[model samples]
Target: MTTRELPMTVPSEGLPARVRIHEVGPRDGLQNEKGTVPTAVKAEFVRRLAAAGLTTIEATSFVHPEWVPQLADAEQLFPLVAGLPVALPVLVPNERGLDRALSLGASRIAVFASATESFAKANLNRTVDEALAMFEPVVARARAAGAHVRGYLSMCFGDPWEGPVPVPQVVRVCKALTDMGCDELSLGDTIGVATPGHVGALLTALAGAGVPAPVIGVHFHDTYGQALANTYAALQHGVTTVDASAGGLGGCPYARSATGNLATEDLVWMLRGLGIDSGVDLGRLTATSVWMAGQLGRPSPSRTVRALSQQQEQ
Candidate 1:
C-alpha cells in the first residue's frame, strides 16, 4: 500500500456513485485464443477473479463445441466454480445451450445478438431478425426458470461490413431484447470504433426509446484506444454497469478487426481515480491479471497492470 500504487481520488459530477463491472475474461477473453486453455486453468482463473472481488464473472459459454473449441469444456468448468458466492453468468446461444447451462444449475445467462446483419450472420449464422427469433424462446425459458438473462448487442457503434451503424438500428434491437425479458442489455463496441459523442448519442436514443440507463451496460474494446473514453461518456449518461476483461484478454473471433476488451485493471484504475467505487481490490485484481498473463505465456495488455506490477517489483 504505497502512494504510487493507487491513483488520487477526484470525484466527477453526474456519474454513478458505484459501478458494477461485468468481468468477461474467462468466456469472451479466452474464446479467441489460438492455444487451447485447460479447464483447470479456466476454473482457477474464475476463482482468482472472484477472490479479487469481481462479483459478476462470466464463467463460460455453452455454445456448441464445434463453434468454440476453447470453451468446449463448459460443463467441466462451470461445476468447478459453481459454488462461488457471486454471480457467474454464461452465454447460451440457443435453446440447446440454455438446456446445457440449466442442467448444471447456472442461474445467470447471456445471449449474444448483433446490431448489424453481417455480424449476426458471421457470428451466429443467422440474419438479425433470425437471431432474435432464435433467442426469444431462450430468454423466455431462462426467465421462466428464475435465471437472470443478459442480452448482448454487438456492433452497437460500428460494424466492419456495415460500416457506421445507425443509432435507431441499435435501439430497435435493444428494444427487442428488453421486450423479450432480458434483465440487462450489454451494448458492445465490437470493433472499438466508437468515439465519445457517438456514445452519448446512442445512450440518448436508447433512453428516448424507453430503455433506461440502469439496465444498460457498456462493453468497449481498445482497438482504437477509445474504450475508456467511451465508457466515461456512458458513465456521464448514468450507466452503472461495464463489461471488461481481466488484463485486456479478448477479441472477436468472428470479426478480425475487433481487438481486446477494455481491461478490468484499466477500468478499475480509472474508476478509482475518478473517486467512483467499483468494489474491486486494485492490488489483488492486478496480481490476478499478472498471474493469468503468465498462464497465457504473454505480458498483460493492461497499462494499469504493467505499471502497478512494476511498482510492486520496485
Candidate 2:
C-alpha cells in the first residue's frame, strides 16, 4: 500500500498560533538516572531552563521516596525554584503527594494515568479505574487549595507490555481527568511507537469526543526516532502545548529500549525552521543542553546537537 503524503505546513487555524513548551528535564529527566542529582544542581538546571525562555517546567514529583528516591528533595527543590518567573509544575501520584506539593507551595501539579491496564498496574500499582479514583481527590484537593492541575495520560500510542493500545481507552482516561478538573491533559507517546498517522487519528478522535484542543498537549518519546514527525502531526491537529525534555534526558525505566523525550533543542529547531515562534533562544538552549549532558556524564542524544557539534568540530 502506498502511503499518502500530507503537507507539513503549520495550519493557521488548526495549529494554535503560539504554543507553550514545558521543560521536564530537571524532574522527569533526572528522575530516571542512577545517581541522585544534587538539589543545588537541580535548582540551577531549572533556573537555566527558565532563562532560556521556558515558561512552564515540571519541577519534581511529590511521590513517596520509596518510589522515586531521586525526587526526595521535592520540598526543597520546589521552594528553591520559587524565585523563578516561570511556572513550576510538580507531579503528584495521589492525595499524599498532593499534600506534600501543597505544603511546598506548588501552584501547579500534574497527575498521570495509563491507557493500558497492564502498564497502569505495573507503573502505578493500580488498575486504570483505581488510579483515576485515586487522582480524583488529589484533583479536588488541588483545586480547593487554589492550585491548577494538569493530567498526563501515558502509553497512549503503544505499551511495552501491551501493543497497540485502543484509542477509546485513551479518550476515556482523558475525559475522566478533564471531568475531575484537570486544567490540561498531556497525551504521552510513552514508548515512542507512534507515527504521524497515529497522532493525527488520535487527535481527530479526541476532537470528536468533545475534548477541546486547547486543553490537550502532546508528549512524544524518541525511542523509534519518530517523535518529531508525530509532534508535527499533533500540531496540525491544533495542539498548543507540548512536553519535552532538554537534551533528551528522560526515558521510561519500565519500557526496555525506550529512548528519552523529544529533545527541547530539536523541537525548537523544527519549530523555528517552520516559522513557528516558540520564543526560545536556540544558542542559549543548546548551551544549557551541553551543560546538562556534562552533568549527566553522557554525550547528548539529540541529533541536532550531534550535527551542530560535528560542524563546530570541523
Candidate 3:
C-alpha cells in the first residue's frame, strides 16, 4: 500500500512542531501477556521499533520473574540491543532490578509510582509514600552510575477504588519523584478515564507548581477511546514526550478492567496529520505492529494498523 505523506509545515497553532515518542511496546506492552515471548523475538521487536524511527524504545523490565515472568529474560534481552544507537530504557522496580539492569550495561531505567493509595498497595504492595521511598535509593544508585532515570506515576487521573484522583495529590507525588532525581516523569492514566479537560487542568496545576512541561511525558490508555485526544491536550500544553505501545500491547495487569495503551500507530497517525514531526514512518510503524500482532496470535488493536494493513491487502 502507498504510505500517506505528511505535511512539513506547522499545521496547527496549538501543537508542538515536533514530538518525541517513547515506545514501550516491548516491556510495558508485553509484560502482561499470558503467553511467553522468546528473548530473541523481544530483541527483534526493539530493533524493528528503532528502525521504524522510535528514538527511545523500552526494551524490557528487570522485575523479579515471579512477578512478571514475561520479562524474565531481561538479562538475555538487554545484551542483544545494548549496542543500538537509540535509547533503550528498561523498567527497574527496585534496587535489585537496577542491579540487574546496570550489570547488563543499561544506562536508562524507569521506576513506577502510583498517585492513589489503593493502586499503590494493589500494584506495588506498598503505600504511595513507601513506593517513593523505595525508588529514592534506586534512582540515587542509578544516577551515581550515570544512568538516566524516568519515573512513572500510575493512576494519576482515575483509580478504580478511589474514583477521581485529586490534582493536589498527583502534584505531590510528581514533586516527590522529581525531588528523588528522576531525569523525566511519565504521568500514566492507568485506567484510561481521562479526557482533554482533565488533562489540561492537571497540566496547568503541574505547570503552576513549576514542573516544566518539557520534562513531563503523558501515558494514557485508550479504554474510553480518548487517548489520542488526551495526547493532543498534552502536546498543546508543551509536553514533548508521549508514551505509546506498538501494536497497542499493554494494560494494567492489576487493573483487569483496563484496556490496551494508546497505540503508537494511532498516535503517529494523528501526529502526521497535524504536521507534527515524530520522526516516524507511518507505513513502517504499522507494518511492525501488524507483524507483532501475528506474534501475539491476534490482530493489532490499533485502528490505524488495522486499516493500513487492510489497505495493503487490497
Candidate 4:
C-alpha cells in the first residue's frame, strides 16, 4: 500500500480489536441532497461501497416521497443491489414504510427517532413518546418478519432549539427502543454538538439503564469537529459499531444546523492507526469517495479522502 493509503499501526489499550462500520452514505448521506441522484448511480454507489468492504450498508429509506425525494426511488433501487453479499438495511419510518421494505425482501430495517421533543416535533411532526408509539408496531412487525431492526435516536447530545440535552433524557428513549425489540440502537449526534465527555456520559448512562455496550452504536456529525473524539470515547466504552457516511455526504434535513456525518474514510484511517480492524481497504474506499464526489459534482469533504487523493495526484 502507498504511504498515503495506510496509517501506522499503534494499537490503543482498552479498545475493541475490530469495529463494525455501519456505512450510511447511501441512505443518510443522500437523503439531504437538493437534487435527486439517478437510481442507477445510487445502485453503483452501493455496489462500490460493498466492494470497498463495507459489510453493513444502509441501502435506502422507504420514507414517503414527500419527505425524502432523493430516495423516492427506494423501490427501484433496492432490488438492483439486493444480491450483494452484504447486509442491506433500509430505513422504515412506519408500518407502511416497513411493509414497503419487507415487500422488497429487505432483511434489515431501521426506524428513526429523536431524544428531544423539539426535534421530534420538527422531524416527525409528533412528540417523542408519540413517535416511539408509532415505531413500536413497526419494530414488532419487523422483528416478527425476522428482519434485524435498528433504532436511530437523533439529537442525543444537543438540539438546535433545545440546547444541551440531558443524559437521562437520551437514556429513556434508548430504553424504549430496546424494550420495543430493536436489535440495536444507534445514538446520533445529529447536530454535531457532542463532546467526548458527553459521549462517555451518555454511554455510561445507557449502560446503567441496562443498555449493553455491544448493542449500542455511535453516529456523530462533524459540525464542531468532534466526531472522531466522540467516537473514540464510545470505543473506550466498548462500542464496536460506528455509523459513518462515505465522503462525508450527509446532514439532517430536519435540523438545518446539523452538518455532515463522520466520514467513513476518516473513521477507517483512525481504526487503522489505532491497530483496530475495520476490514475496509483505504485505497479503494478513497477512490470510491472520489468517484462519488464526481457524481455529486463536488469534491469530497473527508479530510482523509482529500489528503490521500492529493498524495496520489502528486
Candidate 5:
C-alpha cells in the first residue's frame, strides 16, 4: 500500500492573518499521562518548546498533589525553568495554589472554570455558582498582585452527562471571568464534540453578548476529529489566541471520552500555509514533539508529527 500526499493549502480568505498558539503540552499535556515524567524531562520539554519559537508556554499547574499527582512537583519543577524567554503561565486553582505560584515569582496564572453545571460538579466538586464564587477572589488577587490572569472555561461545547451546551451559558461564564479582570479567556471544547457550526455560533453569540472576541481563545480536543475545523471557524470569527498541546497531548479527565487538545504542529501547518505568522518553526516543533513522544515511550498522536517524521526519514 502507498500513501498519497496532498499539498496542504490554507483557505485564501476569512481567517485571521496571525494566530497566537498557547502551548499546553508541558502542563496540561504531561499531567494526564499515566507515567510519572521525571522533573528533568519535564523541564527539558518546556525548554525545547520555547526553543521551537512558541511565545507562550503553559509551564505547569499548581493544583493539589492529591488531586493531580502527576504535577505534584509543581513547586520544585517551576524553579528549574523560571526565566525562560517566553511567557510561562501556571494554573492556580485557589488562594493556596495562587500563593504557591506567586511565591515562585509566577507573573502569569490561569484559573479553570466549567461552562456546564455537570462538569463543574464533577471536576471541582462544586455547583457552577459555587465554583465561580471561589475563583472570584483568586482572579481578583492575581490581577491586583500584578499578575496576568488567564481564565479557562471547560465543557464549553458539550457535556457527557448533559447533552449539547447552550452558547449563552458559555458566554455568561466568559463574561464573569472578563468582569473579574481576566486578561484572556480560553473556551475549551472539553469533549471534542463541537463542529464548525457550533464554534461559529458560540463565537458569534459571545461577540453579541459584549464579550471581547479578540481576547477569547479556543481550546479543543480531537475526540471527534473536528478540532482543527472548529479552530478554523474560531479564526474566521476573529479569535487570535489558540490553546494547543504539543504533539496533541492532554484531555479533560472528567469529560468522558475526551481526547487530546488540538496539536500545535497541526495548527502551525494551517497557519503557515495561509501565510499567517505563528512564530513557530515547523521542523523544529515537529522534532521537539517527536523527541518528547520518545521520552514517553509512545508515538506522537499528532498527524502532523507522524507525517513530518516519516517525511524526514525519507
Candidate 6:
C-alpha cells in the first residue's frame, strides 16, 4: 500500500499542528449494542485500541445497569486496566455514578449536560440549570479527590425534542462547565445536525466568552454525513481536540436516525492529508476496525477505510 503524507506546514486557520483524538468506542460505542458483548471482548477491544495509538480512551460509563445494561461491568472493567498507560475516562452522570467511577480508580471523568431544556429533562431528569447545578458538586468533589474532569455539552447543534440550539445557551453551558474547573469541554453535536457555519459561529461565540482554545474539543456524529466537515470547520476556528470512534461503532440509541460518530480512521486520514499529525496509523486503525466489525458481526461505516481496503484488494 502506498502511504500518502500531508505537508508539515500549519493550516491557514492557525489551528494547532497536532490534536488529541479521544477514542470513545469502548464505552459510548458499545453502550448501545443490543447483544451483550462479553466483558473479555470489551477489554480486548480497548487493548487493541491502545495498541493503535489512542492515548485518551473513554473506558466506560459508570451508570446504573438499569439505565444502560451494556456497560454494567464498568466497575470490573475499569479496575482490570491497571497496567495500561493511558488516560481512562469514564462518564459519571451524578454523584452515585462518580462514586462508582472513583471506586474503580478512574483518573479522568466526564460529566455531561444538554443545552436544550427538553433534552436535559428527558436525559438527565432535570432542567438545564438543574443539571449544571448537579455537576458542580460532582466536579468539586472529583477535583478534591485528585481526579481530572471533562464536561460534555450535548446538543450543541440541534436537539431532537427541541429545535436548533441557540449559541448563547451553548456558550453559557460551556462557560459554566469550564468555570467548574473541568480540564476540558467536549462540544457535542449529539444529533449531528451542525453545519460548518453553525459550528464556526458557536465556536466563535464560545471563544468570545473567554474560553481557552486548547480546552475545547468537538464530538460529532455523522447523522447528516457532516461530521468530518464540521470537524474541519471547528479546526478552522482554532479548536484542536476531537472525539471519534473506531468503525463508527456507536450511533445514538435515543435518536435512531443518528449515525455513529466520525470514524477514527477517516478522521486520521483527513488530518494526515492536511498535514495535521494525529500520531495514529490509519492502516492499523482500519485493521482494528475490521476486527471490531467482525466481533460485532457488522460492517464498518468508514468510507475511507472501505475504499482503501477495496483498492488494496484489487
RMSD of 5: 2.6
| lDDT for each residue of candidate 6 in 57-136, tens digit (9 for 90 to 100) | 89999888888899999877887764698889999999999998887677798998888898887778899999999999
After superposition, candidate 1 runs with Cα above 4 Å error:
none
TM-score per candidate, in order?
0.99, 0.94, 0.97, 0.99, 0.96, 0.95
Given candidate 5, what's the lDDT at residue 246? 92
Give one digit per residue, the lDDT tens place, for model 1 in 1-314.
58878989999988989999999999999998999998999999999999999999999999999999999999999999999999999999999999999999999999999999999989988999999999999999999999999999999999999899999999999999999999999999999999999999999999999999999999999999999999999999999999999999999999999999999999999999999999999888898999999999999999999998888888
Please give the lDDT score at residue 164 for candidate 3. Answer: 95
Superposed on all Cα atoms, model 4 deviates from the true structure by an RMSD in Å of 0.7
Candidate 1, residue 162: lDDT: 88
lDDT of 2: 0.86
Which pairs of residues collide in candidate 2?
none
Q: Write the per-residue lDDT of candidate 3 for residues 143-165, one digit (tens) a residue.
A: 99999999999999999999999
Tens-place lDDT per residue, model 4, 159-185, is 999999999999999999999999999
- Segments of candidate 6 deviating more than 4 angstroms: 4-13
Residue 157 error for model 3, in Å?
A: 0.5
Error of 2 at 153 (Å): 0.6
Deviation from native of the Cα of residue 3 in model 2, angstroms: 35
Which candidate has the highest lDDT of all?
1
Residue 143 CA error for candidate 2 (Å)?
0.9
Please give the distance, in angstroms, between residue 305's alpha carbon in candidate 3 and its true position after superposition.
Answer: 0.5
